[model samples]
Target: MTEQGTVLMTYATARLSDADIEALGSELDRIRADVVASRGERDASYIHTVIKVQRGLEVGGRTLLLGSLLPPLWLAGTAMLSAAKILENMEIGHNVLHGQWDWMRDPEIHSTTWEWDLVTPAAAWKHTHNDLHHTWTNVVGRDRDIGYTIIRMSEDQAWRPWHLAQPAYNLLLAAVFEWGIALFDLELDDVVHGRKSKRELFDQVRAVLGKAIRQAAKDYVLFPLLSGPSAVPTLVANLTANVVRNVWAHTIIFCGHFPDGVEQFTVAEVDGETRGGWYLRQLLGSANIDGSRLLHVLSGNLSHQIEHHLFPDLPSNRYAEIAPQVRALCGRFALPYTTGPLYHQAASAWKRVFRMAFPSHPRPSHPRPSHPRREAAAVAPYAMA
Candidate 1:
């Protein structure tokens, strides 16, 4: 049977007793309280100030070039920097708005109608992200992230065209349109999962198209005319920055579940399992990443993806503190727990993608043996889902 099918079959049969569910709930509650207590001081005020300062600097930098104090090449460079800043605002700041930084306040209230301009609708991050991706991770019929058009997660998705040409196509796609693909997922998921009425789906498509057009006009026409020819260079720079930011986001997200050790499940498997077992699968089938304290702070410590899945509402900052307890719990359950350095985990995920896309391609069959100055490990048994 295919891996996804196998996972579904296993999930269908697995059962958790009431005591197990209660224990899982108790553990989650304890972790939530600890996270809130420890990271409660994350004032959104300071974060807002930083964003404003960055925007002001970008504007002033553009104005300087327009006034002829700075060269055109300098203007172009500055514009690119500004664009990067915008991408950062979307990726990093958006997570903060999700209360990945602070859970005391409702993110929706702060994100949709806050005085502080801290949200990005471009990524459609919340809908495809917080709602779908996290909630239905690795479930082929449900997890929007796994529906790679050119890449298959398991043998079930294997097809002649994909087997023949997907590797090269997927690599280029990942480099250029990872963000675009993620955006596409929002609509595709609704169709695939039958989440929308026919009329609602059509309306959503029209709404998205209109939003895209308006954004393009604002970025390409209005901004250039207002800022002068310098805005052209700025636009290019911004585009490059956006690519970098998205690539980072894609890499970070992929590592959580795409590494060799992680398992992929089908709808049947997940449906068969109890809530506690499903939660355990999410934890065991995911990997953790480790880096500097500041890195964890910036990326929402999503390297600790299992913990995040298990305790979605908890502040990310608390992942480090709960790491030991989580490890102990998994050990007690005899469940596998995987972790590694950031690059190590990322490389593993990337390699897995390559393997899935190009079956004949030869790469390291295992995690890199060489220990870099900083290396991450991926922990998993050699069992298929």
Candidate 2:
């Protein structure tokens, strides 16, 4: 079973009993405890090494771009810059901001201290992503990442005429995902609906603008200008590199969340939820990408989305180490472990984008009752398209 439409509570009811769920949760807790206890120098070294490599790539890429007038240099420089951006945004920035390395007592790498190389401020992202999105996971209305409130990602989401253009715009979103994420972190709908104040919205917008301008000046102005005669080519190379990073980040993220067999939930399903229930939801709701160590590193180890979702603050390097235990736990529980290769997973997520653009009835076997809270939460002020 690659794709599913049922909410998590109903899915769980049909599979595991409450006692079984509790047992599963206990097992998961043990796994987490083991990892937390074993975290040491090896894990610390992995993150530091990644950071060093990323900085080297960025420096080398910019140096090469200074001679971007040469075709080979332009290609090589652009590739290196793209890789560096991906590493910063994914492996280092994302995990560090998740407080993955805070146990090291390294103030420089602390979540509260590190600012990412994106248009969104670290604080804003932590609120929306680390707080809201992670807490809510795949809950239909509560999680804003479901189609990012622009494209239709779940059957529970009401389809609109605008979604007809999702297949096209989703492509644009992937190319400029950093900007899309910056806007998404603003929670514009909350401001419109009075859930968030205009003052708060204004403050966030100001922060975003500040970050955007700095990022623009650094990439579009300062670096390009430093190249003098190669300024135009350097500018283009930087732009190309950013686009490449954005697209790769978008693809890896979508693969982790939207691929086949990944489940979604209604708010009702999660009501009075237990820790085990949350674990089950995370396990069922997330999909994984089957890839190599290099692929995992480039993805910030998010290829093990299930593990990351279950242990968001765990070091990225450990997800691979613990993946087998997680998979085995799933096997023991007879729960589905959804995973696929990059191409297949990416295609599956995109297939959902196109397929869910049009209206369709819910599956007859699991008829969904009205969820007023879920419905209201899903409603936004306006469609982007």
Candidate 2 least-lDDT 10 residues: 376-385
RMSD each, Å:
9.9, 6.7
lDDT of each: 0.56, 0.88
TM-score of each model, paired residue for residue? 0.71, 0.92
Q: List where candidate 1 sits over 4 angstroms from the true fold.
A: 1-25, 37-39, 43-125, 189-198, 358-385
lDDT of 1 by residue, 219-302 (tens): 455555665756665555445544554556667777778776676665544443444555666775678887887556445567
- Which candidate leads the pack in TM-score? 2
State the TM-score for model 1: 0.71
Specify the highest-lDDT model's number: 2
Q: Which segments of model 2 are wrong by more than 4 Å?
A: 1-9, 12-14, 363-385
The clash tally of candidate 1 reads 9
Residue pairs with backbone overlap in model 1: 8-269, 12-272, 80-237, 83-238, 339-377, 340-376, 340-377, 341-376, 341-377
